[model samples]
Target: MSSVDIPRTYGALLIGALFASILSGAVAVQSLIYQKMYPRDPRSIKLLVFLIWSLDTFHTGLIWGSLWKHFITDYGFSAEIDHIPWTLALSIVFTAVLTFSVHCFFANRIYMLSKRSWILTIPIVLLAVLRLISAAGTTVEMMILQSFSNFRHEVRWLFTLGLALSSGVDILITVSLFYLLQSSRTEGGRFNGVIDSLILYTFETGSITSAATVVSMICWIVAPTNLIFMGLHFVISKLYANSLLVTLNTRKNLRNRNRSVSGSGSPNNNQALILEARRAQGQNSATDSAFHVKSTEV
Candidate 1:
């Protein structure tokens, strides 16, 4: 057996717990902002927000508990480090649940935005469910095996598949939303800015979660002996939670902008914007014309 570097193995976990803690704070703040900004949001949505926050809080506690078991409880016994802690096993399940919830939420959005296209949303949902199942299987195996080395040898493929499915679902959702928003663009260029903003948000939200999943998968594959992969995995659920919260909170701002544009019933501001754009174009045209004149003279 390779000698375990306590700092590398355990320090990774400590750093991951710190990151999870910070992201959890962001989740709480975003949830508060969402409540204040959209008080009339559907009861279902409010409940979802509360549930995600609660799960995140509990997930943090579990990470800490696992840390305590490793560092404090088994202070003198290094052999116990190999065994999977109950808190850590449960944390994996919680992460799977959180990821599944967020995935479902985005899947529903894609369904609505795609005009109730079951064809598009069904595949994403299926993939998400499969990911959840994989995660559950991983937890069960972890408990039964009770050792990281054994779990890695027996069912590392399950964990890898879950991460791949998660990344795939996120990409699918982002592309679907981006395509829908792009197609909805106004030829008149009035709502193009709004559509562009939506596109950016879609890309950003998808990228964050996808990137984390991919990195975690890489760590698991490349360095199975270390806890770094497990550490990265700890942050994945937090990223998903914050991504959902940010997406939900920003809807109010986007909707209000759209409403203001509609309610004013006046094209003056739009016209001014158009005129300003034209002015810039005209200046560029004149500069080009002058350059050509000088070239001809020379």
Candidate 2:
């Protein structure tokens, strides 16, 4: 490796390591908070959030480990020492699996949010199948190491297809989410706020993942630079952290709203009810003085 490449490689590796730590920590913290706040739905779509973060944690760790062995260890980048075939195979398989899980998670969220499964489910399933086929092809080529160069060519094609399909899925999900949010506003329901929050969280997470995948694809096209992978890793790590924070805030807000709604039914029920009704009416009035004050604060 060139002198420039050495620092770049290690720097990328360190970033991936940091990302791994952050993702892992966020998963732990979020899991505990969700468990405490919503024990009944522990196995709900939120669990998939933890699953995705866990996959990212492992993925980043694997990238970091490979970089460490290549840059820090005395072992040269021989195929055997690098475990090139095994690494390639594992990367393809695990990445496909992760993508499938993500699609499923999104589909589940859409279903829970809108009670509309068929809309998202069909496309997600199709894309997941494509990803699995691409993964299998790449893994097969890696297992037969004698055709490594040919395998790289095949893998490149698979990566390109995977990228396109994944991007399409993300775009569709984003549009669907926005549509759901718009519909929710006029069609008020019990879980409207929760649904909106989930949709926003899922859309943002998908955007981050798609962006990382784009960077990874570029690295594949140009050169196998650790910097690209590291950048993607860090992006995902930050995405997970931000997602957890958003979820926590949403949960807190929901709790506060519920409390506000419930607290008005106490011994001072008559006065509290009247006050709340006034507040509600004022909330809907364009000329309400409090509305202006709250809007200014916002």
Candidate 3:
């Protein structure tokens, strides 16, 4: 019999598992900070925040269980896990769900910031739903097939389509959000600085997810039998969860910094101060009208 070399990939999987654990812990801490700081956020926004964290916890638990069963519990012949294990499979579904959740959150942000233009929001909303469907299809395909060779022969296209859709959605959201912010910037460059930070932050998060998905697709196409893609796949969802949480938690610091800059007599300080005051009030402020709109409109 030809050697499958499946055992060789467990080391990579272990590394992935550990990396995911680290990211998950970071996400949890960020979620706590978000709750404490943004308690007055609209109920819809609060629910989204809580839901993302809860899903991240669940995904991490599934990853741990899968790794333990394959690597620690069933050492010998555990290499078969390279094909596809139930937990790993479920992790894929959880990732789809997690990715969809974040994508929807950003999509709604776009709707709000773009002033509720259906033309702008519809594409992302459709793509996100399609992504979830394709991802679910991929998961079901894996479950039914149960072997990498069979997966490769039968439903590899579904897997590729799902990842492609996911990458496309992230790219769209990132580009559109940056464009909207840049276009919405007023004179005096006060908000310009904030926009700059937002553009950078958006790029980092968007590119990471898009790159990981693209890389995974390439690896799957190039070497379907190897676990090379597993390295990226495991932590991909964590990146999504962390991206949103990080954005949410930074509001406090962003507000404080704006206040400090205002006190220093910046020309646009007046406008910044108004926005800062609104955010500080945390009540029914227009701060939510733009990207901060509390509704789940998308």
Against the hidden reference, what TM-scores do the models get? Answer: 0.86, 0.65, 0.87
lDDT of every model, 2 decimals: 0.79, 0.52, 0.77
Instruction: List RMSD in Å for every model shown.
Output: 11.8, 9.9, 4.4
Q: Tens digit of lDDT per residue, candidate 2, span 1-298?
A: 2322655555665675576567657666765665565444434345565666666566656655655555556346433232343543455566666666656555554554455558666776687678667766666666775233444554657656766676666666667666655554423333345445545765776677677767766765676533444345344434534444344335555545544644543453222211111121223532111101000110
Off by over 4 Å in 1: 1-3, 263-298
lDDT of 3 by residue, 1-298 (tens): 1334565567767888889999999988988887788767767767887888888899888888878877777777644665577777888889999999999888877887777878878999899999999989888888888877788888888888989999999999999988877775566744557567767888998999899899988987886677767767888999999988887777776667656654665453434412232343345554421343121111
Best by TM-score: 3
Which pairs clash in the backbone of model 3? none
The deviation in Å at residue 227 for candidate 2 is: 6.2
Which candidate do you rate higher for TM-score, 2 or 3? 3
lDDT of 1 by residue, 1-298 (tens): 2556667988999999999889988998998997887665556777889999999999999999999999999887877777799899989889999999999988877765665789989999999999999889888999999998888888889889989999999999888887877776645755567667778988998999999999999999998877898889889999999988887776656656655655554544433111010011333432100000010110
**What TM-score does candidate 1 reach?**
0.86
Any runs in candidate 3 off by more than 4 Å, and if so which? 1-3, 186-188, 262-282, 286-298
Deviation in Å, model 2, residue 231 alpha carbon = 5.7
